[model samples]
Target chain A: MTTNKTVRLAQRPKGPVKPEDFDIREEDLADPGEGEIRVRNAFVSLDPAMRGWMNEGKSYVPPVGIGDVMRGFAAGQVEASRHPGFKEGDTVTGLLGVQNYAISDGKGVSLADTSLAPLQTWVGGLGMPGLTAYFGLLKVAEAKEGDTVVVSAASGAVGQVVGQIANIIGCRSVGIAGGPEKCDFIKSEFGFDAAVDYKAGNLFGDLKTACPDGIDVDFENVGGDIFDTVLAQMNPFGRIAVCGLISMYNATELPPGPKNLRNVLVMRLRMQGFIVFDFIKHNQEAMTALGGWYKDGKLKFKEDIRDGGVEAFPAVLSELYTGGNFGKLILKL
Target chain B: MTTNKTVRLAQRPKGPVKPEDFDIREEDLADPGEGEIRVRNAFVSLDPAMRGWMNEGKSYVPPVGIGDVMRGFAAGQVEASRHPGFKEGDTVTGLLGVQNYAISDGKGVSLADTSLAPLQTWVGGLGMPGLTAYFGLLKVAEAKEGDTVVVSAASGAVGQVVGQIANIIGCRSVGIAGGPEKCDFIKSEFGFDAAVDYKAGNLFGDLKTACPDGIDVDFENVGGDIFDTVLAQMNPFGRIAVCGLISMYNATELPPGPKNLRNVLVMRLRMQGFIVFDFIKHNQEAMTALGGWYKDGKLKFKEDIRDGGVEAFPAVLSELYTGGNFGKLILKL
Candidate 1:
């Protein structure tokens, strides 16, 4: 019998997430039943979307119920299995909850190939974040060659992938990140064409300078003033893919939206919002392309892996919203 | 030589237009020379877009420059023609300025068939407003059968035609207007299935009641809070064809955008802006369909023809923003 250290939701967050909002403890693991498998989670992926899930209302997905195991995407190894598809010691990844051990019936679970990357990389670059960037930039924004592609939260997991993909497709990739350090990182490390430091102010002027031909596709992650600035600089018939509004995710009261939506009317822009789940049918195509790019060295990922196991889940998760984490944040179980 | 009473843009207004902004006086008009044709204007179209045209900035088209004849759409008779395409005394409609007489080379001129409809109707239902509604509802919105289509400024020219067209295509039509009289007018006169009076203070509740199955297509004419409320009630994969933003046109300062734009991400809505001119190439298709519907009694047009000719251009145009006009506002010469 194995003791599983797990984190569960205690209460819905009001503004920013607090450590007291989660109840982290140990639980006795049960053996797998018919058509079931047990996974010993190696890492728990901490995402910006987790903050939205902790809120008490309808969203892309249902809110995490209080006192229930916190839902998360995790990479692990199948320890024991009664399922025909999986044998012992098969590396896998899926929505396996925030815990050291996860019980699964093999629904969303996929084999994580160590030869392509590491086990932890499955829940990082090649995971949900990578797929989100793939579908959002290519499918939603319709980024093509000779286009100017701008993405907010550029140093983060999804944004980095979006910029790289834009470069691969021959588009000029401009990233908007906080501070000079992260801005420098995206340009030097991820090969982004240009990086604009949002914290430095002069967003509109800086963005205008970055995109001389004017923005064609905007992968909006951070909303509010940043979005408004980008809106004003959009060329005619531009596409805005509303991937995430990380700036408003933890707000106690609803904040005002982009003040420059008039640009939408004037510029004849198309603004569409989408989630990764919306493209579930095309996940395999995204995975193949992402894996190919990663292997060819055209793509690289920066995983900000934190320590202290499942007990540190709440503390590490808070870093994502505050710009404390520099990359794809993950908690080492 | 004919004496032409014309309204020229004397100066740009700060907010809601003032009559002093125009230099309304008589000018000596010359006869047709070479390929030029002279038109004696009868009716000048008064539209919400006139306010935007008065502003000094980049838009879908150039701003009405100071000292230039106020750009307007008008229907009139060709007094003389040197162009082979048009004959003398031919009823025509085009971008003839807000004047008693206009000289054109017959570039955009379209012949008005009095046998199908009246001459004034050429600048009303069969003109810009009618084509705007037709293209915005059908092409831009892609409104199909079983769609719950909602149009703001329902009693106005474009809104009335949008509702009627939605009905013709087997969709549920909902209209949002200011007062009870206009609300009653849209339902009774334009055949809108439901009418929500936005002046009734409970816009969200009333709109919810009006659109029972959630809005599929939002033909947004009025922006500001009205557009915000409509945005919140949109269904997943909903299409919002932003035909106009009448509420913000006369605003001295820009208002905050929709507070419920989060619904755009949650519901995965696609909001796109478009002008009637964007579909200029498809004008014939729209005209044929609209003319066919009008002849079949499926479409009805109400032209609010205000007397006082070119001098009334500023006052009659003001009525459009203030919601004083009942239908397609037309200034008679």
Candidate 2:
């Protein structure tokens, strides 16, 4: 028998997730079942969506139950397998939770390739965030050449991919991110046409300057003031793909939605909310296209990997809410 | 020359429009110029959209500038014409403004046929409201057979047509109106599947009971609480054709949008706002279909004709905001 160290949800978070809300535990692992494989997690992804999973409510996915292993996505190599598909030493990625080891039945598990990119990139750019930006901008928003696409959290995982992909597709990409450094990184590293520092006092003014032709597509990640301001700048028949509302995830009560929603009518806008899981069947198509872009030197990615192992999961997760993570956040176990 | 009694926008209303906000005056009407025709207005349409036109801001149409005739839709007889398309004694409908006589260039002027429906019906059922309902339900909301559609402001012009058209297309139609009388009319007269009186309290509970299968299409006319309640009960991949938001028109400041907008993502809802004018090119198709429905007695309409001529435009327009008028509100000159 082996010991598996994991983080468990101790209580449902009322507002921002606190360290006390989770309890770290060591449990004896049973041998894999007939159809299950054991994975030794190399890197666990820390996402804004985790904040939503910690709450007790109905969402796109079920909330993490109390005393259960905290739900998360991780990239790792197979340690032991009784499953027919996954063998020992095969790199795989799936919802493996915030732990050193995970047992899976090969339901959502996918083969991870680190030949072109690093193992951590599989849990960052080439993972859920990449697929989200791909399907969201192309399918949901229907972004086309000559369209002006605006992305919030522009230097982060999904936003970086969204802006870079928009550029590759012949559209003008404008990014909105916190701090001057993140903004500069989006324009210089991601090749976005422009970047606005939302943390600066002149967000609306900077947005107006960035999108002089008016925003045609809005890839919304952060909700609240940023969402509202971007909405005001949308052109007629604008398409908004609402991927996440990270700003509102930690609120104790329902926050007021965009007051300028009246523009949805006046400007004849189409606003839709979508979960990346909905496009699971089309993952191959997204992977093929994104991989091509990556190999062609058109797509670039950065990771903010922390090396404190599973014990640092609670403190590191809060960094996402505070905008402390500079890129795709990952925990190295 | 003829003396035309007109209602002009005196000042932009701060909140709900008042009599002081408009000036009722008599001006000498100019004769029809080259290719122009003059129409003697018999009935002027009083639509909730007119309230939006009163504001000094950009909308689907330009605002009615202060000191200019308050823009409106009217049906009347052509008194004089120099245009080959129109002649004296011809019944016509167009944007004739809130006045006794209007000089036009025959642009957008449609010949009214009162053989089956009344002349005022040209500006009501067979006009912008009817077109809005037809396109909104069929095209925007994409209501198909067996789909459950919920319409707000069910007794009003657009709502009545929306519910009835949904039923005609083999979809289940449910209505949310203000009072018991309006609610009863929707069921008894309009042939709706069910009606919920929003003013009777138990809005959320009643909506749940009414839409047990969950709303697939939401023909949203009245926003605010009604919109929020209906949103909570929407099914996955639901479509919302936002026709109007009359409840928010009179507010001095922007009211909070639906707090449950997060459902847009969880349920993968598609919400689009559209203007009737955007479908103007397809007006003939809509008119032909709606007129056929009217002549076949498959669609019935009632008008809340308010007398006191154009002078009463200020007071009568308020009736729409107050829910005092039933059916299609029209002001007879």
Candidate 3:
């Protein structure tokens, strides 16, 4: 019998998640069922959306119940398999929770290719974050060639992919990041047209200069001031794909909505909020297109990996809100 | 040459429009040019949108310049014409401003049909407000048969029309009005499935009770509390057509946006803001459809015609915000 180290939700979070909100425990793992596969998670994804799942309320997905293993996405090698399609040693990715091993009935489990990309990249560029940017920019925002695309949290997992994809498709990409380091990286490494450092206190002015022709597509991740600023610079018939509102995920009370909402009427803008799961049926199509871009060297990504096993789950997740993580955050068990 | 009594913008309103903000002046009317027609204004349309045009900012249309005639829509008779498309005694409707007489070069002037509907009905049911409800509900909201449609300001021009049209197309319509009388009118006269009086102090509870199946389409006219409340009851993949924000038009300072905007993502709601002019090319189509509904007795309308002529424009316009007017508020010139 294998002893699995797992992090479980101890209680619902009040605001910023405290370490006490989660509990680390060791449990015996049962053998795979007749048609199930056992996965030993190599890398668990730490995302801003995790903060939302910890709260007690309605959302795109249900809240993680107390005493349950913290829900998350992970990429790993299949350790044992009773399923005909998946075999031992096959690389797979699925919602494996924050644990050492996960047993699945093969639902939502996909075979991953490490030959084309690294293990971490499967949870980074070719994972949920990558697909979010792919479908959000191309399908949701309907971004076309020569369009000016502006994205917030440009150094984060999804925003970075959004900026790079915009560039690959012949659009001018402008990124808004928290620090000078992220801003510089987005411009130099990611090949963004312009990068605005929001921490510089000149976000509005900097954004104005970066997008002179006005933002045609706004890929919103961090809502609040960033959303309000970008909204004012949106062109007529602009499209805003509200992917995430990380800034408000941990708030005890929601802040007022964007004051410039009237701009939607005046500019005839279409603003929609979407979840990646809504486009789950089209995952293969998105992965194929994004995988081609990755092979062509037209896409670049960075992973912020933390090594502390299951006990580090709560602490590492905090890095998303604190701006401590520079890239796609992952946990190496 | 004839003398025209016109209401001009004396100064921009700081909040709720003051009578002092307008200046009524007598001016000599210009003769019709080679291709111009002279219209003797019979009924001037007073709308919530006119309040927005008085503010000094960017909007769907430019602000009414100081000392310029207050912009409005009117249905009147063409007394003289040098234009081939129009002649004497022809009823017409256009942006004729707040004046007794208007001269146009035959642009945007549409011949009004008083044969199928009354003259004032042209401004009430076949005018901009009627077309606004038609296109906003069908085209923008994409309301289909069996969809639960909720419209704010249910007793007002656009709102009433929206409810009636939703019913005509086999959709269940719910209306939100201010008083018990208005609420009763919407249910009894307009054939709404349910009506909630926002002034009843149980707005949230009443709305939840009324919309048991959840709102599929929200035709928003009045913003603020009404908008925020309806937003919460929206079902998954709901559509919100932001036709007007009358609640915010007269606000001295813009109020905080709806806090539950995150529902947009969780519910996968598509919220779009649109101006009627965006569908100008389809006016004939919209009018023809709405007119057919009216002739079949399937659509009924009531006009709150204020007999105060052009000088009473400012006072009558205030009735919209105060809920003093019961139906389509129009100034009988």
Off by over 4 Å in 1: A1-44, A64-70, A74-119, A305-326, A330-333, B1-44, B65-70, B74-119, B306-325, B331-333
lDDT of 1 by residue, A31-106 (tens): 9999999999999899878887888876778899999899999999999999998889999888899999998998
lDDT of 2 at A125: 91
Residue-wise C-alpha lDDT for candidate 3, range B5-31, written one tens digit per residue = 999999999778889999998999988
- Candidate 3, after superposition: displacement of residue B243 in Å? 2.2
Better of 1 and 2 by DockQ: 1
Candidate 3, A68-129: lDDT as tens digits: 99998899999999999899999988788899999999887887777767777778777889
Q: Judge candidate 2 at residue B59 and give its lDDT.
A: 72
Q: Which stretches of model 3 miss by more than 4 angstroms?
A: A1-44, A54-56, A64-71, A75-119, A305-325, A331-333, B1-44, B54-57, B64-116, B305-326, B330-333
Q: lDDT tens string, model 2, A49-119?
A: 89878878667888999999999889999999999988999988888889899989987787776665677
List model 2 lDDT by residue over B1-333, tens digit each: 899999999999977889999999999998999999999999988887787788776678899999999998898999999999988999988889899999998877778777757888888777778888999998899999999999998987888999889888999899999899989988999899999999988999998888889999999988888999898899988999998887777688998888888888889899999988777667667877888788888888878888899899999999888878867888999
lDDT of 2: 0.89
- Candidate 2 clashes between residue pairs 3 or more apart in a chain or in different chains: none
Using lDDT as the measure, name the better of candidate 1 and candidate 3: 1
